[model samples]
Target: MAAAVFLVVVVVGIVSAVVAMSHRSPVVNVLSLVVTLFCVAASYALLGAEFLAAAQILIYAGAILVLFLFVVMLLNAPEEQRPKEPRPFQRAVGLLLALLAGVGGVAVLIGIEVVAPAARVSGDARAIGRLLVGPYIFAFEFISVVLLAALVGALVLVKRKH
Candidate 1:
């Protein structure tokens, strides 16, 4: 069923995102991130948001991820080195924090109520464009400026003298 596939894709995305963070090598992390993004695109497709799915793949997975890999290779980032042995106190603190997070997540899940939205085929390109340029125009422009600023900042940082 579509629901089952969507669930699987979302699960894969979440798991890959976590695994990406845990990776020591930057290349592996980026690769896992790509997988996570692809899973997100897959879920968007399952939801019938074909435009969103294409944007996810083209923008995040294609452009942004390629840019990340280019920067990584250009900078020649080294693999992270871990201590051969873990510290007892650090392990205890990590476990405590993880347990606390797990408990908080469970509590939040139990407390939240699900409110389903009315069904609409608002995923069409024309509908999405109209929504973006209509009432949401200011928000859309603001986000574009923010992303542009971020891109400029990233370029500046990457080109900075050591």
Candidate 2:
């Protein structure tokens, strides 16, 4: 039962991610990404990492998604207009590339051999917190700085357009 649910969550996550990337409208992309993020959280819960699941929902689904929506609205980004007629040549080339990529991915997967299983690590909140503040503290701080810079850039762009 758990495996079945996990499979469903993973499928939904993949599908939603594809939808998010394929959409032209920013609002549609955001909505699809929300679905994808929620599915990811569901996947973590299914894998018994409840702490990670909760964090995924709270951080990515709640805070980051809201921030994305705010950025979309602030920028007043318009939906891209689709071409009146589809280009068959472009579609054919894209299809051929996609097929080639799929073949390469399958070949790589088949060629790879695992010597030994990786060590299982704890996913508890305390352990994660400790790791965040421990040797990875610089990485954590760097991410925060990057996010801050992005927010500042967004505000500047908004102001400049006026």
Give the number of the best model, judged by TM-score. Answer: 1
**Model 2 compared with the native: what TM-score?**
0.74
- For model 1, the superposed segments whose C-alpha errors exceed 4 Å read 83-86, 115-117, 159-162
User: Candidate 1 lDDT (Cα, whole model)?
Assistant: 0.90
Q: Whole-model lDDT, candidate 2?
A: 0.89
Clashes found in each candidate (C-alpha, N, C closer than 3 A): 0, 0
lDDT string, candidate 1, 44-126, tens digits: 88777989999999999899999899989998999888857879998999999999999999999999998896685658789
> Which stretch of 10 consecutive residues in model 2 shows the poorest summed lDDT?
114-123
Writing each residue's lDDT as its tens digit, candidate 2 over 36-140 gives 999988878766677899999999989999989998999999888886775999889989999999999999999999678556566789988899999999999
Per-residue error for 54 in candidate 2, Å, reads 1.9
